[model samples]
Target: MPSSAAWLMALLLNLMLAISTVFIGSCLSESPSKVRLVGGAHRCEGRVEVERNGQWGTVCDDGWDLNDVAVVCRELSCGAAIKARSGSSYKPPAPQEQKVLIRDFNCRGMEDTLSQCEQDGHVYNCPHTKDAGAQCEKSPSKVQLVGGAHRCEGRVEVERNGQWGTVCDDGWDLNDVAVVCRELSCGAAIKARSGTSYKPPAPEEQKVLIRDFNCKGMEDTLSQCEQDGHVYNCQHTEDAGAQCENPDIDSPFIPENVRLVDGPGRCQGRVEVLHQLEWSSVCKAGWNLQASKVACRQLGCGRALLTHACCNKTTQGKGPIWASQMSCAGQEANLRDCPFRSLEKNCTHDEDAWVECEDPFELKLVGGDNPCSGRLEVLHQGTWGSVCDDGWGEKEDQVVCKQLGCGKPLVPSSKARKSYGPGAGRVWLDDVVCSGEEQSLESCRHRFWGYHDCTHKEDVAVICSESIPRL
Candidate 1:
């Protein structure tokens, strides 16, 4: 008979064998079995195909459904399965392409990959025309305002799987409205209404596809909001609706379609403008600091520090040159409002315009005896520059003092210049005006940045009543 130690050794060996079996089985299950979606609008939604024996072939739709598709969507890391389509819904496979090589998927809908699902057999039971297709929520969806007085007001309908459907108003509110307004380039959300408040064009016909949307009012699209996927409990009568104020022609909100791409950050990049749903570059001809200023302000950036011409750098762009011969006087509210010539084919992308804007303005008191008293220097375009005293007064001084948390302005109008002395560098402002109630110096009316006519002798300075921490 074997000793007790030998019995224990056998038990340990069995335990080691069990763990090794599981590790090997898991690794084998995850081995490469390539699957792809083909012949659809985008990568995420298409006819299903799988690779077998070094050849690619379609999947038979004999038993395809949302449950089977859920495995495929999970394998691709797509959010969730929106729909499972077969036959005529997707494009037919080419004549010379391989026939269906996979069929009869019995997925529990939580498998890591389609290959892990139980299949009837490795056999072809259908023709290429009967291939399966899937649409996932990860695909880009389009949103539009319908049945309203104008483009910016009405019933909110979203497009998914190439079909238009209404959103359920179960939890819709101003937060959702804000996202819709920003997406449509409308200024801001005026009101959020329900289907009961604003009757859509046709109620019973529209399908309710989305429900319980949770939005933070910052997303660029409605589909980005967290929501239940394809809720069937909602009726068109419960559709979401909104009223948005159209941005004024000169408002920066109207030109929110402009963006900076392929740069270090949002404020510096090759400039692009959305025209007819396509992004096009602006030609460098006649592009200058004035045009750059409007682009910067419209993008919620600070003053323009350098244009492509000013920096002598080039970033070639693709597609159409939308505008040329820009002639801005540096005060236009939006880039579109500036006078510019139409497209010129002769211009190439190498002449595409770019801009480096000053980061959001940073204020500091320099050359003073203490933290709260000094020449008023502003950090712009990566440099500390002086503000002009051409229109300096207690009103302007009060704003500067409050912004720095320096208690209050100490210099009375009678003794405005207490000899903090003039500052050197670019004169960033001139002819300033303030109403004493503004929060910051930038909010006050002033000449365009870097357009001052005064010299350093007129540089502005101030003395505050309290000393604050150093910046």
Candidate 2:
């Protein structure tokens, strides 16, 4: 019904709209390349990694001066450059992709980006040992750890401009604690200590730095997390504090330990062990029921399940297999006790063996063979876990003794906390407060099941009047 000229004009307008829409869409979808510090304990310290072309590769630290590092720190939203380090502080991975992405980045401590700074080239001829490392500090704001048993765990403190202040626990949780841990290069946020539960507070100038911190838990540093960053109505007593857990070792995988992981239930999953100071999977080659039997006993499980629905070959982990060519006669008390050969070649993590065993001790003692004379372990929700000594008392020990039918408790001993070995699997319970009148150990005030504020070293132990044999 319209004229040709009118229709022509309408079509041109529609074409223009489509073109503009596409231009805006492309702009919105474009993701800027990012740089992150990796392999260090904190977000502000580590080997430099740039995310470009959808792959993360390392940068050569050969010409890594503090001036260049300042640009990187400021670009990543961390505050100031502290030190530009060379040489890997950690052991290099046995197998690495080792892509050299950036090199010879020269900055004058004022540039906004490495790309903006002068560089010799995008790709450099350098060894991985020359990989750049850096440590950044948030200027005007600083974080420190104190009052903990170790350097890693502690009451968190911060400094702003020239005045020092404490953070409040208004919206504190593990996620917020995680940001602090990452900021400090501590392992992970174990627990948020509240109400002065750790120890007497240190005497200092009373000032609150930041409050109402809202962290998504994935932030690299606390500076990147959302917070009041300004005002609050909290007293110094209500000031927040954090306890972080450092990794047992400075590696991606834990070594010197053998444990089950990623299973739906306990004592089942991919079999992994530490060999040559690196944790790796056990190859399925030469694996059999006899081999599985040794694994079950080594982990304190009763027997191996043969059903595919419950047990099957497991090949889930990253990296190559560690051990192979196993031959077990089914009577071995420990997997390490069984005959096995180490293999460096011809094995992959996908070929790792898997097994599930019958449930272990519903309730038992560990770190000693005696029935009533070791660390307390409870079987709950298909896993064996340990309790903490935070608020443990004689009343709580009495219930444990009564539940085990191990006779009346005699002088609930804290010494056993050291005499008995630390637990291996998980620190499962904490802040247990029991009344002597309770019928069982479960009837006590404590953190939620699987919620704890301790490491294995702080596991609680008990000693009863006499040892009781299992029924």
Candidate 3:
């Protein structure tokens, strides 16, 4: 028989061998097979899955945020993360040994790989139905799609600081409207509505976001378009909204067309409707701000700048008198979408209706003790709101100074430390991309006129030379 001491030594050797085998197995399993995006429309987006034990599985959406999504995007070199999707919208691989390999992820949005993220190993509370999804993009968008009747038509809203807010309709136009439609893979914008009218109650915390969006009509998302960058200059009434027409649906509703003609800008012109293949003028009988708003937004001109009582101006081109009056809730995308009298009532050339949408963005300064320095604000019709400090620098500041006749700027600051304080109203404009060669600040490239992601605390302030009085 073996000695007791020999038996103890033999037991220790077997234990050591067992530990070594397990460690080596773990090491082998960790590498080669990696995290990947699956079940998405594109390779860069889809349900998040990890391979383990030769089986692919999903991750729980619990505590899943942009950080976790970012790590996966970086690992695959698929650009930046556009969204962190929730629910099992993307179906996972079936009947796997492990349906929930990665229980949960706690990444800091800086991890190089998904394995580096903290996970809730041996998850018992999570289920496969809670699987998470992600969308990585070559050009990530700050915009999101939510609460639409179908996923394409709904009140226009934006995300800021992790909170969702409605967009102001002050300067929303066709190009701006089109971007939101295309972002959701929807058809062109058939209607641009205002958040203030016939709309559901927004979250108490819901802010009135981006107002004036200037897209070339081809920008991928609203964030890619030019904006004003301040919130204090707009209201919920100006909250931008849109309803997209699904391209997949053939023969969409094409309403009678109305065009603004003979005005200085695209926004300001006499109203004309298409009838019998020949455009005719709309009568000014019942023309109101509500009706004019629809025309301005539908025409891609923005909100109604001014409704000319030009019942006296003659039509410029070859359009005859058409409708008597048009009634709109100020939310319709098309003027013809509204209730109108198509009966060709008594309307002469002198009774032509004209509407001028906002043009040459109106800007101002507020919250400053002196006119030279303070919070920035812009005028979109009646409401007055402030501008954001994003992308605000020397070049843009110089233009503001020149516009206000403040002379040279002493210190152009993104934060309004020296100013009175944050102003009241919606924060508009963000990521203003200025070329530095533009004469005016408004002329400098910017995001939608009223869209912003910052608070009034981040309002821009400029200290001018005070414009010394020369005797």
Candidate 4:
């Protein structure tokens, strides 16, 4: 054995060597490390690992927080903090040798990298080796509708987070469809459809994934839906859509006793029968003698009349009354009997000049089988709709009698019971109080007109005679 002093010195040396080794190992294991960002826009991710004795080692992410995410964002030059998660992809076999826990980190919320974040220590109790990962992304501020026809049969696209995407038609109901119609201001929702009617064929990538869609009944835009948590399986054919209709209007009746005038030259005049309103032009189309004769007779003019080709001057070279040519068979009754074009033209010399007619004596309808033969037929609505005889009581008939300058009501049938045909769509006339002050039949109050379910035979008719004389 060596002397006590020498033995003591040797022991001390060994002890110092062991301590130095530990210090070196610790320094080697806890050096600064680098991490790389992965993933892409709106969602970002990254991993970090330290170099120990030329070997890469990962730190546990237990200590990662908003501050650390901020540092990562600053380092990467990403705008701001979004989110962070902790867990391990790798775990050590030895319990004590597990990755160090990232207990605490402090950073300015706007920082870009973990390296810039202030940390409590290198050693951590992070549960797994792959625990430190994060995601940072930009957010969208606005949403809007993009393309397609906004009418009844069109597709609607949306823009969000700086990108455009189609809306999934899944779970689309009336409430949702209603909103879309309202947005376009296209009346009400007539139909709601799924399984795309207007999608592009063969798309390279998927378009949209709508999870939950809640729409207010009147919203016209699909983006107005409040989406829930569901991955929308919007395939090309699964895009949603809708259809709409136009609303009904109040005044849609035509006038009576309208006639066309065959002027002195080819540029003759034509007129339309509107409500006691006034006479307007039929404009001009292909004008032939037969059609002119029909128009003249319909206006109570006796026979075939002359024909005129009204030119640019009459149409003023504008509007729907552009150029027109008409053809008619004498058998037809009205000016509309002719088929014509809707453009304007210059009068040609070959075309006959104006047409004239001999007015027929006013003939009233009698209670016999030929009731409608000599009486005028008035049109209501777009079609030849009807009016009810609701107000045709004695007082009403008395007024009609005086207006026609004839006798009293020989027979007043309220429901068209005596004759035959479909009843009017709906009886619009009720309690019609006609006074002798009114001039024409149209000047009566209860003459409201609308769609009627009447056939030709049931049309309202009147009969008048000079006196109780002959029959």
Error (Å) of candidate 2 at residue 86 is 2.6
TM-score to native of every candidate shown:
0.29, 0.37, 0.36, 0.24
Note each model's CA RMSD in angstroms: 25.7, 16.1, 19.8, 32.1
142: Cα error in model 2, Å: 11
Model 2 steric clash pairs: 41-185, 42-185, 61-132
How does model 3 fare in lDDT?
0.65
Estimate, for each residue in 1-471, the C-alpha lDDT of model 1 and write its tens digit: 899999999999999999999878866652226566765555467888775544456777888999988988777555589899873465434333355677678789999788888765465547766778888765366677865545677888886764466788888999999988866646679898875555324334346878878999877667788988669777777788988875423322123257777777778888887654467776667577888888898765888998873223345676776654656667654565454554455666777778989668678887666779887888777888988876577888889998888989887532544576666668887767676777777766565578766888777788899986665
Model 2, residue 272: distance off in Å is: 14
What range of 10 consecutive residues in model 1 has the weakest lDDT sum? 247-256
| Prediction 4 global C-alpha lDDT | 0.45
Candidate 2 wrong stretches, greater than 4 Å: 1-32, 75-80, 94-96, 111-116, 122-124, 137-471
Sorted on lDDT, best first, the list reads 1, 2, 3, 4
lDDT of 3 by residue, 354-404 (tens): 787865466766656577776677766557777666556776677777877
Candidate 2 yields a Cα-based lDDT of: 0.67
Ranking by TM-score: 2, 3, 1, 4
Which one wins by TM-score: 3 or 4? 3
Residue 170 displacement (Å), model 2: 9.6
CA deviation > 4 Å runs, candidate 3: 1-183, 188-269, 272-290, 296-337, 340-349, 356-363, 367-369, 378-385, 394-428, 432-451, 455-457, 463-471
Candidate 4: list runs displaced more than 4 Å. 1-286, 293-322, 327-391, 394-399, 407-471
Instruction: Give lDDT per model, in order.
Output: 0.71, 0.67, 0.65, 0.45
